[model samples]
Target: MNALSVIDDLKRRFPNEPEYIQAVEEVLTSIEDVYNENPEFERYNLIERLCIPDRIFAFRVSWVDDKGKVHNNMGYRVQHNNAIGPYKGGIRFHSSVNLSILKFLAFEQTFKNSLTTLAMGGAKGGSDFSPRGKSDMEVMRFCQAFIQELWRQIGPDTDVPAGDIGVGGREVGYMFGEYKKMAREFTGTFTGKGYEFGGSLIRPEATGYGNVYFLLEMLKTRGLSIEGKRVAISGSGNVATYTAEKLLSLGAKVVSMSDSDGSIYVPDGLSQEQLDYIFKLKNIYRGRIREFAEEYECQYFEGERPWQHVACDIAMPSATQNEIDGDDARALIANGCIAVSEGANMPSTPDAIREFQKARILYAPGKAANAGGVSVSGLEMAQNSQKLSWSAEEVDRKLQDIMTEIHKQCVKYGTEEDGYINYVRGANVAGFMKVARAMMAQGVL
Candidate 1:
């Protein structure tokens, strides 16, 4: 029942896996007060059981490249917990994909899914394969090779894998096609599919649109609104772009967007035409953010994030984990930033989060704020099960409802004596209580 002691044991057991350990420590620390109050949880040893994954699958993926050269990559799927429902999560393809990262992701997914009120468990799968410069054919071949080892372990009613960072619509199509051939059934075994198939509407835009929805709710708590708020968002992927699109539509100004190379800061804010161009540049052309600067003659900071340099009312770190460190957090606070809604998993480091808490700024964690993507994925499963697809409006309405409910849950658990909401503590405790009760009821399976 001692959270630090449990963390010490985990650290000794998982010495080199900092990501996983960090994830566990964060949740355990946040929920320790409630966890200690429940003698049933301690008697059942739920913390130890919940920290470890139910199972992990690792395989070697061998695929041929464009020039007839063979490549080998390590593939992994960590099924963390399925006490609530079937295993569900995304399949990432990046050079940084590893057991530690996937485990951390899966652990977070457990609570994220619980917050959705959906029937899904936590799981994550990926390979250390980079698709940046690979040809379409080469990527297709790699997808097939990766699925050859994964197909048997996944299904629509079991573990449904969707797309992540390096895996997109194209990769999902390639892998789903291969899964169809291998399984000989055209079920919704995968999500984020093209509309030509059984894909749900608004699935692609769910995460970004949902992030803005949560941000608006947070702003409401302060008697403010998204209208005319200047925003700085990191990452040029789907989450960032569509978040900008949503923010622009709501009359908010999006001042910055970035990729791995650098950031483009448009002091005048980006127009719809410019955002369209960016869509073509990154999505269609696979180019960089620097191209935006070249085309629009804006300020481009080479090899720098958009955080420290941009002053805005809101900051959205849609990039990878640990992107915003203590320095970035300090700069954001000093520059008059008011709120941050994470669109990526664990994007803020511990120091950055502390700075935000100390400043008493409105901050939402990734698990609660970014649950829209998976929430819609759960909708996709429902539609597939019933053989029906909802319209875009229906899906959007459902996503907004889910994000609103998640915000309510955070407020329910996270409110303090001074009336300032500690959303991280709230989200962690709210999510953990649900899964913990479920685990206890399931009788330690």
Candidate 2:
């Protein structure tokens, strides 16, 4: 596959896109050996085709604020691939949203969807419109405006987008409303919808729960149990909150949770009451992590992450990408951490991932570990099509089963000769093979 050469060509073609380049480099490096083994793939020139998106929609989202002011923001949708099925991914709405980040996310989603054993391809879209400190009316108006430019490009059997950072049920609801009015039909155009509208029962908790579920399977391989394990989790949003909820129920001690403002640590681990308070604080009141510390009398580190500050047996990076670097990885390993299950996309830098792999700790990448959300989103599409809803228990059971299967794939492909499970290599290769075969059968465009 000439991995280095392909990367060099890409860097020149797509300059100033560190995140996208990093993502492509990682996947290509991992699958180079397998890709080169099959000459048919090269005959189709599939690597370059797979690396670029099929189409990207870029437009301006114009909305009016409560102050009667018009605001304009750039919005984008990158349809990376739809060879296997319809395009599927999430819409992020953070201020940090940019072409590089969205392109990287869409690239990663291509493989993540392949691993789910579901008929879904890959895409991603979002705007740089931050909802923080914005009024409900303003947020709704912005969401509606954002969809105005994207409604024509998406559909139930075409491309379905859920939610990601700075996007939630409320935002989805607003977008769905606008889409319904624009498209003149009601369909499962989006996942992560309000349950009353068509959202799956466990959709919100899927990613977080799936991460813990994957972690459990990893632990099982080593004859380890989650009970009594001290956990340090970053981020206090849906992923981290539900992860802590599931962990507490399974008898794990969660000692830390964080936000963009900082991290809070409870030496004895957070109780159900404490986590509930955090749920209200972050979700309902939209407060910061410092509020959790102030309310519970715990230590709060301002402008810091939880990895190096808190000692634990496990570290889950549930926040944004690159939140953990080499230093954080070393601290976690030195602090007796044995596993890292990512709840956020590409949360660990390359250097940090290398450290985790070198330490031989149980590490699951975000694509494999955090794929539950999209898994259930796929389920949501099924439910919407069948005009039926599954019970909470049914959805949860399916989620667990999906996670177990993903772990098995990682074990089958990622295990090194030295007996260390290189999950990164395993997940990348496993996901790539599925997409590669589908693309080959479909022939080159």
Please write out the lDDT profile of model 2 over residues 171-221, one tens digit for every residue. 999999999999999899999999998889989899999999999999998
Error of 2 at 197 (Å): 1.4
Q: lDDT per residue, candidate 1, 296-331, as tens digits? A: 999999999999899898999998988999999999
Error of 2 at 436 (Å): 0.5
What is the TM-score of each predicted model, taking all chains together?
0.99, 0.99
RMSD of each: 0.7, 0.7
Off by over 4 Å in 1: none
Model 2 weakest 10-residue run by lDDT = 289-298
RMSD of 1: 0.7
